[model samples]
Target: MKNPLILLALAATLSATAADAAEVPLYETGPAEDSSFVRFVNGGQQPLEIVATGSNARLTLDTAKPASDFLPIRAGKPIEGALVRGGAKRNVSVTVQPGEFASVVGLDDAAGGLRTVVVHEQPDDFNALKASVAFYNLDAQCASAALLAAGRNIVLLDQVPEGQSKRRQINPVPLSVQLSCAGQAVGQPLDLGTLEAGQRYTVFLVPAGKQSRIFQATDTVAR
Candidate 1:
């Protein structure tokens, strides 16, 4: 009873709409209202794909490279997404405030599982004459840890709780990072090379079987 011409036109319209939808990207540019940045870090062994949806949303992040531009998500709104690794996935979420710098770290659980930890990055107000350093605890096996600057006889951070981070501004120095648990050293101290002025850095304490080790990455924060 339906006219053949009418049916063909309807089919054509539907096809064109679907094609247009596909051309649109899943993550669009955030509005000017968004004033903060959230970076994603994949600390797990497998590569990860990160996504977030909310005000001033961010398109997906590929592999291990952090979002070149910090996610322009609205402050205080919940940004939720999933982390896909090797065909398997896990959910992750976080809320950030205006002018705040935050990150989501992908970590491995004790039972061979995977999870995410949301960390509020310490703000850096240092000028070109100084530098900043922050330490993150990702070693699930280690309950707590500390960072000592070798030969300086100084403790940069003490009693850093698991899944948390602490940061401080310091003069340019050659730092030997050490991790301790239950007041005992986890392993040999790690030479963090040299920290230069006007740069922001993060040290990640990661698990190595019964003990743990340290890895570092430079943040893209402008001084």
Candidate 2:
């Protein structure tokens, strides 16, 4: 009923249109506008559970896995929740600014109660040619903490006070480091094998009896 040459031309036009549409990029769904990021870290001796209010998100952390992936939350609003340990619950709240990143650390108080500390992460200018490392000092007995290259006298991070953190950018390479607190070595050397460029890392010095224990984790965001 239609001209054969006209039909072929129409088909080619439709195919080109479909191909152009497919080439258009599709982006992932991101966090809400003005949202901040927050993560949980268990600096205590026991397993910790975070039950968020009005949300179904539940995060658990223990000595073996002491950190959680970052989650998006409304900025400038207090996040009300409970920290549960061994069936015991303690109410906790944390707040952060818009576009900020924070870590909520659960610790054992001197009075034998569950407590929390919010550590705001300092903004950094990312370097694509280097690796970023952050050190968190959660050991109360350690007035100051330091991270040094194992078998070498070089210190990567030094004089980090208790309840705080410090970050630095370094060359990407296979490396090992030792944790020291109060001028004494705290634990066995930590082997951080073959760091890649543009990656981020975090090391924590958590309290363990009279001494301290060290662990490392790669920073990640919750999808």
RMSD of each: 11.9, 14.0
For residue 122, model 1's alpha carbon misses the true position, in angstroms, by 4.8
Candidates in order have lDDT scores of 0.59, 0.69
TM-score of candidate 1 against the unseen true structure? 0.68
After superposition, candidate 1 runs with Cα above 4 Å error: 1-34, 51-69, 122-124, 151-153, 221-223
Task: Show the colliding residue pairs in model 1.
Answer: none
- Candidate 2, residue 43: the lDDT equals 77
lDDT of 1 by residue, 1-223 (tens): 2111100111121011111112221112311344655666766655666543322222333334432234345577666666665656677767777767777776656766667777886363655656678888877677657777755546888777777888877888777877767666666777767767776778777665566777666666211
Task: Write down the TM-score of every candidate.
Answer: 0.68, 0.78
